[model samples]
Target: MKAVMIREFGDPRGLAVVDLPVPVPAPGEALITTEAVGVAGADVLIRSGALAAYGFREGHIPGGEIAGTVTAVGDGVDPAWVGQRVWAFTGTGGGYAEQAVAPIGEVLSLPAGLSAVDAVTLGSSGVVAHFGLAHAHFSPGETVLVRGAAGSIGIMAVQLAISGGASAVAVTTSSTERGRRLRSLGATHVLDRSGAGGPDDPTGYDVIIDVVAGPDMPAFLDRLNPNGRLVAVGAVGGQPPADFGTRLMAAFQKSMSFATFSAATVTAAAQQAVRTEQFAAVDRGELHTVVHEVLPLEQAVVAHQKMDGGEVFGRIVLLNSPFH
Candidate 1:
């Protein structure tokens, strides 16, 4: 099998394609013949060795979400899963290959009429957005502000907020054109990435789904209304200052809250359920999957480079079959 691995870390150039023996499904796992895989911001972090403290090793295969057909199933798994088109979570790695293995519990049957590209694009990111909102205790009539709302998860958060009946869906994007694009996805207000204007200015938001947490994060705490909940789902912008907690203390009177969320923290069943629901929504035309571009599996390095360049507005998918 041909797989992309981080031959070294810190540069997109470190991602190299090499031949490897195909991985076999362990008990309760399924081996999928890859059709497509999603490249995410976390892949960039892993490639750069930023997640080493979390057990990510050098030379690791770096992909999380994949869409493919199951070719085989392990012990205790139902034979029915074999030969089914599905989307799956490959956990931290093993997805950047022609074949990948995932726990049976992590595999989801693709909704009818959903393409592999769209399946991988929305599979994991949609689950994160759904769980992030649930963590923040978002209410239907409340206002929502998706910080750095241009990535895959951020895009999903915007639409989920609207569908959940948010009185207003606000987003902080990098430019007017990107903001306009988000508006087309049902964003009611598009603010600059500076986190100003709209619900963040005077009125404040009832819930804020932030994907970018950096030095600017402390400032967004002030944008939360009383009793507001700010759930940090990703920190592509790097960590906030150690003293950032002081911001929450300063807002003590307002009872504002702040916490970080990861889909890993949620139960597998819960995550799978959300993925199923979101995929069905997409199949039904009630949700959307925004794919920035599609590249072949061999061009994994290019995909990582584009993600590092910061111009990617949505998910970038890699097809196992080369493009002619």
Candidate 2:
């Protein structure tokens, strides 16, 4: 089997595709012949050594979410799963290959009418958005705001927020075209991502799902209604707000609450549920996965480069070379 491995940290240039022994499924796992895998912001961070504090090691394979066909089942697993087409999380790594292993319990069959490419595109970001919205508890007939709306997770968050029943879905994005895209996806308002154009309503927002939390924390906090919740899902912005503590103290009077969410903490089974729901939504045409591009598996380095350059919108999918 062939896999793309990080030769060293700090740049996408170090990524190399090489032949390696196929991974064997352990107990409760399934060996999958890969179809497609997601290229994500987290993958960019992993290649640059930015997530080393999270304990990422050098030489690790670079994909986490994949859509594949089960070729073999491990100990204690039902043979019925051996021939099913499934989507899964390979966990921390090992998905950027011709073959990978995923726990059988975590592997989900592709919902009818959902393609491997589409499912792979929605894989991580869609699940994160789903789990993040679960934390936001967005309700119908209420206003909701999605920060960094042009991002993969942010894009899905916008659609899910609408489907979850928010009467008005406001989003923050840097470009006019992207804003138009979000509006077409059901965003009622498109605001500049710099945290500008706020304090629009004193009643504030019923829910705020923020991914680019950092210096913009106070601004988003101000947008929340009394008892409103702000779910901080990511920090592509780098710096934490300098006055976060003081801002929190001042913002405390509104009775709003703040929580940070990482899909990393969510259980596999729980995430699988989100995956199933989102896939069904896509299949039903009630939701959409905005994929930017689909590259061949050999171009893993190019996928990482585009992500690093902030040149990608929605998600980039890598088609496993096996079928091609």
Candidate 1 deviant stretches above 4 angstroms: 198-202
Global lDDT scores for all candidate models: 0.91, 0.83
List the lowest-lDDT window of 10 residues for candidate 2.
194-203
* Model 2: residues with Cα > 4 Å off, grouped in runs: 198-203, 322-324
Residue-level lDDT tens digits of model 2 in 45-161: 888888889898888898888998999988999999987899988878899999999877778999868999988888788888888888877777878888878878998988888
**Candidate RMSDs in order:** 1.6, 2.2
Give per-residue CA lDDT, model 1, range 88-179, as digits (tens). Answer: 98888999999999999999999779999999899888989999999999989999999989999999999999999999989998888998
Q: Pick the candidate with the highest lDDT.
A: 1
Cα deviation in Å at residue 316, candidate 2?
0.4
